[model samples]
Target: MISQHDFRQNVSIFENSLKIEFKVVIKSFVKLNKLFILWLIFVPGLLFSSSKNDSLLQVYNKHHSDTIGLNALHEYARNLQYEDFDSTYKTNVLLSNLCFSNLFEKKNLTARERYINIYFLGNTYNSQSIYFMEKGDYVKSLELLEKSIQWWSLAYKDYLESYKNEIYLGLSSSYSNKGSAEDYLGDFAMAMDSYTKALRLNDFVKRNCDSSLLNFVLNSEAITSFNIAMIFENMGEVNKSQKQYSKALELFTALTKLKDERVVVTGFLGTSNVLTALGKIYFKKEEYSVSIGYYNRALQIINSLNLKYNNRFNTEYADILTQLGIQYKKTQNYNRALELFDKALTIRRELGNKRLISISLNNISSLYYNMGKYKESLLASAESWKLAEEAKVPQQKIKASEGMADSYEKLGNYKEALIWHKVFKEVTDSLTDQESIKNASTIEARYQSEKNENDLKLLNAEKRLAEQKIIQQKADMASFQIKMWSAIILSLMIILSALITIFAIRQRHKRILKEKLLEEEKNRLRTVIDMQEKERTRIARDLHDGIGQLLSAASINFGMLGKTSQIMESESELFSSSMKILNDACTELRSISHEMMPRSLQDAGLSTALNELVVRSFKNTSIEAEFEILGALERLPQLVENGLFRICQELIGNIIKHSGASEVIIQLYKTSNEWILRVEDNGRGIISADTENGIGIKNIKARVSVLNGSLNYENGPEKGLITSVKIPIYGQN
Candidate 1:
């Protein structure tokens, strides 16, 4: 079994190996795929921050305890930088959240809300600025940084004021970098002032040793001091230059002390770098022993720390070796000097440091020139010139041209030396002009672009904000309309429901009233019908008793009169006719009394009475009528049968009186819940208009309506009018 620590170590090693292998695989794939290669090239280091490891958060949290939430937000902001946005949308989401959290504090809510409406405006300006800076547009970078600083100033005036020292340190770094860019552009005076300002901030922040803040401050100061020292050295201000170098060393030392142990050895190595610079200075003053001591001290420290010497140290080491070589050559130790020069060249070549190689070559060539080995000196000088030209550094080019000029001059080639010197001057002057243009243009364009982008962003933000407001208003209006419509529909539904209830109730009351009126009318009609039936019964009874007795007495008297007048034959015939007339008159009177009351309909049934009437009417009339009967007509009441029989008699009488033709047909049938009666005649056709105007049609309509049935009178198909009526059974009920 592995020990716990060893197991952990193994796991870590495995993880690291996996990471390396994965990266290698990805890189290989990317090399094969152009699209992947493009993505890999531009994808990493995009947001310019790293993950918030414990160390970084600790740094942030220790400094910003007063605003832990803000510190958390800041950590989140920083962490968003490393998110692989190429394949993931999470980064954009996190970035947006970070932006909102940072900008939209309650303090800046109003302004931030306006700012976020355009979303990308302010962010785009900042992004473009950083983009230009990376593209070597130092001037543009500086301008954008300054604009960003101004934006932070306006946007976080209170925050900056509260964090005055930190703000000043940041401003100093910006100015210092701007100055360095200016220095590269050959604006040495501006560079000097900027470096001075940076040093001032560095000094102030150093006294207040807040390590986290001091890190940036001291780092900026060290860079600025180094730059200032270089400028002084260039201008031949050796004393000022040494002072600046010493200041840079002090600041770097102070920073290293505060750094982590991992970087502590590197800090000592930084001190070694200062020793090398000191060596160069001493060499410039012709203090050979002191210069050697500084150089040896630097080399000893580098070896002790086991540090891999970078180009800076390697170049410095080579210079010192060349210097030693030159000093030996002056002491007439030509072989020892040549050996030193060879050692220096080896280091230069190992470094692939062409500029140092040229310098080494120049030293060797000078040493040869001093020994009167003219041909050997020219060869060395030509090699140095070639190396210088290949190096392409401005200083290297000048040194190479000078070396060639010297070589030519020594060879007595005056024209060649003049041409090399002129070429040297021309190259240096053009380099200086081009460098100036690049630096100034970078600064100016950066500043203007930042300002223009900021303005455009502000405008876009305002427009977007206005659009959002309009959309919100429309949404609010729509919501209001929806509510209004719902309320209106609800109210109308309630009103309609109430109206239907009221209408139904009123109709129910009206129906009840109609039923009450019909009941009263039916009762009155029933009473009249009962009284008329009673009167008819009384008349029929009177006719059967008294009128029959009177007619019998009259007939007997007429017979006696006829016996007395029997002398002449004509007289006897008269008496016989009179007696016969008396008998016929009595019989007709009895029939009239029976027809008026219709006792048979009351005692027996309507069907028997109707059959007897039909037989008698046909025998009395010239017209022959055929009647067909169907169904059991057992349900007929006395009043209904009498009314129907009277109606039929009146219709036949009218038809016989008016019609010249003679055939009639009557049909009676009893169906479910109804009795149907139809009368059809064949006679001279009656005009429809005349029939409608007659009282008979009106009577038939009234009777049919009383029974809740229907009556129709029209010209029959052949020649006469047809009248039909259907009365519902038990309609009165």
Candidate 2:
């Protein structure tokens, strides 16, 4: 068994081995070919790096030393603006892959780190997408920008919970980039809407207010608006184009007044761009002086801020100079025009700004056309078209086409001029339509996604509430059941207590009544005994003095006479009948005395006494009575035993006299708690209502009361009469 420490060590070792393998793969890939190494390193860098540091290989190398060729690749990408299509394409592919890899890894990172990395990936994708757009690959550009948006959205999701403003800023920037892509693809309307949404989101967070950032935003917005204005102007919507250009100028002018270094540099560039747009518009309007004033302003700002915009500013400044040269040519100032062309051409060639070079070449060609130097002008315009095509700027292509048309027309080649003019119109028109379509689709997609998300959230909230109500209902039902059962059990307890109290009270009442009846019976017995004693004495004296002497004298005299007379015969029969009557009365008196108080019950015990009484009472009747005794009936009180025996006798007598019953059964059982006596007969049942206090029933009830017993009599439907009595012998108070 491994100890915890050893287990931890083993895990650490495993992790280290995995990390080493990862490092090996990174190094091996980086060491392959220079271009391949750059591709490998930059892709991961863009994929893994934060949004702020979008330079691919530099970001990759910062993360791990394993990216040995990353720094070299980053340098290569920095110089990518000068590379050919193939080089740029390869670089973009690498950057796109790097961003994808970064996003994959970013999922496992902490929320903050993940957000930063994904944001970096978004920026990389955005750059590549823009590059693709520049190459006239709108589909690929759209795909890359969508991926960028997705990543940025995820990053925003992570950030929104804690840093609401930061995420919103990121979202605004992502949307702005999307707008730019759409704009480039000829989707002007959708592009404008996307840009508007971005601005709104940007305003929601007040962080990007520093002059540099503000100027950056303003310049971007102005450029996009200016592009739209140029489209409108080309399409012959002069007023709309002017409106957009005016908006662009307003933003650019505001930036120029700012003091920040970055703002001042961007403002100068923006002001020049606005002037150039104004010059185009004025040239279309045939307003030379107004166009010249804007053109001159553009030239002054560019020359003054030359160092601020780096080498890039030289290209725009050169184009403006060529346009000025054209303006001079149009006004027939050939010397001044030629002089301006030379200055613009030199700057363009030096800076390798091919598009600007083409423009300056075209201007020189046009000046020659004005001077009637047809051969020189034709050669110049041809070279300018070649450079324009090579530069790959659509606007430059248009300018080059116009120059070719002019050169052709001046040489009396009207067909060629007309052909070039038509080509220029067709390309610009197609570009406008494409841009417009892209813009519309983008806005629609965004709006639909937001609406669906909101609807889903509402549905989820309602579902949760419904589930909560169901749970609460179940809880209430359970509580109700518990209370109901509690009430039922409580009621049962109360009923049990009441039954016990009633039983106790009834027993007490029975005991009192039994004692009272027994007392009354005892007093009656004493009075009967007293009367019997008095009668016995009177009879004895009468027999001795009168009847005895008379009977004796008569018997002796009659025997001596030996005569059969009628009077003597009658007297003898009468005497016999009288003696029989007397004997039956004496037996009945003895039975009554025994019934009132039985000596056998006192002497022979309950079972034996019960047997004797049943045999004697039923012997004279047709009833066949059976007496069954169970348990040890000896321990019970004499009074209780005697009372139970009498109850059995009374029940049997009722069956014999009233029911004309043929059979009677008496059962005397002495259980631990009580003595039970049951008497049943095949007889007409006694009516409990009528016979409750009749002589035999009252006597039995009195005796039962003395013993504190209970009696139950059922007039059973099939079995005639059933009487049962239970005396709780031990619990008697």
Candidate 3:
């Protein structure tokens, strides 16, 4: 048998080896199959290229003689970028060299052809930069992005009017990519500057681009807005971040209403991202429930698209899961929180995302510490610290250090705890040092100043353009007036015709309005007639069921007494019972009559009537009912009082029947301007009040409408229903 210590050591070594092997295998697989994986992920657009693109590629390959061939090649390259980035990069390099060589050799290329070539080259560089950025190679991405910007700038100057906007858009995209790279590299000031440049370019495109291109430009602008929001959120500028996020949400929402399928998909994805960002912001603000709602909406979209396996989707999903875990942890749902954190960690590790991996590890560490698993927490913290060091993310490093310190302190390793505590303090202090804080503040201020300056310049330009437009309009107006004077008699005839048309339209509109009002009056009268008929039917049924039966019983009893007719004790008892039954029949008839139009409402006013109605409705029900009257009570018009009483009766009946309520509170109060009737119940609130409408609700709504009052139903505090009706107290009598 193996010694216990030796067996444990062997198991540990084996686990370490297995982890190493697993990582190596995963990395190798990804490296070897990256192109295939990309193609699969983008299969929707890549696997089935447009026939036009295919034909262009075929023509370019078969005959490469002139600018047409170059254009075809550019189109092919554009299609290739989504499918295979390496192929696109190589093809673009050759295309660029060929175009440059032709220019040098005096091959008579048109300016448009040259500009197209340059723009295509810039797009290729930008595409490559995006690839590198996704791979976390910020420096290399920055270099390529700068090159793309340069090429796009040149193209912007050379391109024709129709193509200028496209080139500017390309430049904007490149600058945005550069900003992302700079942000990842911790140069926030530079990142802000780059994003500002992109925003300006996007604005120019939006103002000048044709309607056909407007949607695409707007989508790009929304994306840039979202990115800027993210940067502001990272910089702790909550107000600016929220403003940009709101702007992005508005743009995306509008885009989703568009008819274009491509625009709709883009809008959905963008909207989901904005929602997730809002959720994070709210999460930080400790609005946990609101954050969860946003997160759930985002997750719904991602899952509905079946995009969980996509890298971008995975990243976002993991982020949301991690956030939810934190929320659950705060709520003391340790098991659920742990499960979510582990899921997020697994995704990050599989994607080989070092930065996110470190962050996830730190999160897990913190959760473990919260759970009081000091040993596990320390181990996770150590791994997190190592990963943070490798990723070179200061925030992750600080979080890991703090986790380690806490874990060590909990484990009674005071010396080690002190060391980590000092490290955490140093990192925290450096981040919040006066100089660093000042620099960050200065960067934010500079960004604002630059934005304001750009706005001023844009305003000046717009003013100049407006002045020119006004001058042109005035000249046109003068010319139009001169032409009108030459045909003054015809113009007068036309104006008279127009006046007649306007008069006819006005007369028609008045007739339609009058007809509509008459129709509405008819409907109201019909509703009142129907309600009265129904009430009569109900009263008739009650009399037949109650008074008629009692009278029949009493008559039979008296007849039996007459048949006995001996002045015996049984006969005497039968006569007394008959008298009692006859008395009840009379009382039942009176109650039925009163119910048709409650006598209490007429005699004692609305307050007493409502209280009596509640008492009668909930008399034997499980629901505890109470009624309260506030303010000085006075009489109201008969119609108003009757309507109020009927509405209250209907609501109380609804609560007893459908609300599953344990308690109900009905209040009638008078404010300075209005009378408020509130009915609250502790029960399952209305799930679909519109679709689940019963006769009771319909009756209440009709009565309220007739009274020119408003009725509202919503969920009450602590899982119940609240129904409020407000009527203007017009001269209470």
TM-score per prediction, in order, is 0.37, 0.41, 0.48
Shift of residue 58 alpha carbon in model 2, Å: 11
> What 10-residue stretch in candidate 3 is worst by lDDT?
1-10
> When superposed on Cα atoms, how far off is each prediction in RMSD?
36.8, 31.6, 30.1
lDDT of each: 0.62, 0.64, 0.74
Q: How many pairs collide in each candidate, listed in order? A: 5, 15, 0
lDDT of 3 by residue, 366-410 (tens): 888888898898888899888777766677888898788777667
Question: Pairing residues by index, what is the TM-score of model 3?
Answer: 0.48
Candidate 3: list runs displaced more than 4 Å.
1-60, 63-109, 156-163, 258-262, 307-312, 412-733
Scanning candidate 2 in windows of ten residues, the lowest lDDT window is 1-10
When 2 and 3 are scored with lDDT, the better candidate is 3
Q: Write the per-residue lDDT of candidate 2 for residues 320-367, one digit (tens) a residue.
A: 877787778777899998998999899867866555577677778868
| Cand. 1 TM to true fold | 0.37
Identify the superior model by lDDT, candidate 1 or candidate 3. Answer: 3
Instruction: Judge candidate 1 against the unseen true structure and give its global Cα lDDT, from 0 to 1.
Output: 0.62
